[model samples]
Target: MSLPRYQEYKNSGVAWLGNIPRHWEAVFLKRVIKAIDSGVSVNSIDTPAEENELGVLKTSCVYRGEFDPSENKAVIPEEHDRLACPVRAGTVIVSRMNTPELVGAAGVVRQNIDNLFLPDRLWQVHFKDAVPAYVHYWCQTPIYRAQVQSACAGTSSSMQNLSQDEFRRFVLALPPIREQSAIATFLDRETAKIDGLIAQQEKLIALLAEKRQATISHAITKGLNPAAPMKDSGVAWLGEVPAHWRVGKIQNFAKRESGHTPSRQHPEWWENCTIPWFTLADVWQLRTDNVKFVYETKELVSELGLANSSARLLPAGTVMLSRTASVGYSAIMGCDMATTQDFINWVCKPELTSDFLLYVLRGMRTEFDRLMMGSTHQTIYMPDVAKLMMGLPPIEEQAFIVSFLDTEITRLDALTAEATRGIALLKERRSALISAAVTGKIDVRLS
Candidate 1:
């Protein structure tokens, strides 16, 4: 679908839609709309207790081009005489103090509730010739948002705001009132359909993730033998383990060890280190395919006291468990790297397969957290790690289970990625639709 081209004029370095119908005109926001400061103050007074007056709209109440009344904060008292930002049902509200990305978040007020107060952080827009809903959708477009962001100023923590006067100076292309209403109605139906489709894709993605996890957990705990007798594994999470499987400490197959960081004061040690040093942040995602930095061999051996330690390069199949901050997260090592003290490396023995052990450890993370020590900083001590009992199968069975899970999970991941991409495309299309309709690229006037 190609958009119709029209003559354009630049305002504050932004192009405005021109060559519009003779009746249409490009006007400054101040000229077409009035920004009123409804001084119904909430910070100075106490909140009311009545259920009817229990809701007050804050900046967060408006999000993603809609007003979420459920997110409203406090209610206004009946005695409050000050007219809280009085906006009609169709008025547009834009957030003034949000981050640059969210600075100009705009939504139309679809319904009117009595005594609803708009916090000072939000700016209410009342359009003259154009429908408020149409303008609201226009402001949500990427082009307009970039303009708003460029006009804003402030530090990173708190974004600078646009005063009513500055907001009035904003230039906008205005179609006839009937055209504006027609465009808004068209967008309301089209965007709602797109949103519904995106939501369905999101649910499918979640279902795929859950199914993948269940498949991995089942294969690791139970052998491939369909007729194997099941026995209670004592732990509620490990309900029925294969009767032939043995439960023993992880230390039986692998050893527990901590990592050390070379002194930062001596930059030389870190400068030449070729060994990959991983911190807690590095373990945030499930896959660590791309490591950011590497450490020198000399620094790894001398400054880091890893000479005898050798940074535990347990082949490509090692399973790693995170033990701090974001605890209980586990992933199979895609490559060999040295992890910080915040991890308990599970080096699988010759009797165990790496992929099989990875799945088992991933399933056992919750149990590991329950056994973790330290009140101030949650940690899984080596002793606690040594006490964990796991059910293991023979080496050949482990390989079979790993191969089955690998094939199944790979399919699930592909489906999940496709659904995610579809959702993203829908969102982009919705934005483009809104931008085109409001900018007069599409004719909304009915014959």
Candidate 2:
């Protein structure tokens, strides 16, 4: 929908704030903000505090016009006294220190959070005349973000700081209180509608993923034949399989192999890097690219490195499953490659196909969740992994299952990609609407 423009406009002198409504003033934030209060840095646990306990807000608590109270850490009892500047209603919390992109992110609190306190990385804005919601909306605009990017100071690329003085000096294209309320109200309704649509797309994506996994799980375990007789597979998780299929330890069909990292202290071992090395860093590529076979990797090791280390150069078509840190993701090696110990490699014998083993690993998400252990770093230990059992289908059936899944997954992926694109367009619209309304590019009073 097209929005009506202000009848009259005047130059605001600021590059980002090119022009404003005739009556609106382009004023420094200090003129409208009473004070920017900061909370003390407190020793806190990683877990969120219970309702009865005091918590310190993490820098992540605020994002582009969004507030997440749950992104807080429980304050240690000894540091409870350090909890100052309790989260208050009608205040906008701005990130004073964070990664470059998120340094000046702001979110307005809708209600009083009595037990939650801000951290040093965030500043609580006390408005003197500005409406908190309107200011919060303004903060999300491209105009405000450009100023934030210019004002941020730090030597490091990863982290930047927005000082209270720099923030106070930033200009706002101020509107009358009533007009500010109107813009905020208009945004509240419009953005919520966009967000709701985005949510539906997200739900669709999730449902599609679940269906995809279920399809694979059923195909691998039950085979494509619906009328096939079934038998108990003895393993509790492998409930039942086709009557003709064999159920036994995966090691019986494939030779289980381990990988190792060459000593980093010996630079000579890492020299002349040539072999593709599969590590946790490359796992993200597999998931994001959604490729069944992994040919490329983030890092490569030298032949010198491999010869000295326990790492072995496995043949093409060998299956690799990440066993530590990032667990359960499996893929077939597209070429001869060595891997880091983070993976559990398998060289399939004549009886089992690498593709079939990969499917079994992918479809066993439930079983993976059950076997995984450790608090900080989850791992499927060697002993349990060695004894892992899977249904063994005939070679022809395995090939058919792989081919069927490839086609069905491709169809589902296309639908998911379309839904993802819808969400992205909705977000772009929401952002554009906010920028237009807040910067006086469009009048939202009657919108």
Q: Taking the tens digit of each residue's C-alpha lDDT, what string does model 2 give over 303-416?
A: 888889898999999999888888888989999999989889999998899988888988998998899999899999999999899999988888998889889989999999
Error of 1 at 100 (Å): 2.1
Best by lDDT: 2
lDDT by candidate, in order shown: 0.67, 0.89
> Model 1 reaches what TM-score against the true structure?
0.80
Model 1 lDDT per residue over 1-447, tens place: 444543543333334444454446777777768544433445433343244554446667676678665555555445355446654577787787776667778788877766466766776676666678878787877657756866785546566676666667777777778777888888888888999999999999889978877887778777677789998887666778898876677778766555555455665556555565567656546433112112322223233434444455444556667777666666655656677677777777888766776778766655866876777777776676667777888888888887887788778888988998999999999888888777766654441
lDDT of 1 at 396: 81
Candidate 1 residues lying further than 4 Å off, grouped into runs, are 1-19, 36-59, 72-88, 113-120, 153-160, 260-271, 287-302, 305-317, 364-388, 445-447
Query: Which pairs in model 1 have colliding backbones?
Result: 272-296, 273-295, 273-296, 274-295, 274-296, 275-295
TM-score of each: 0.80, 0.96
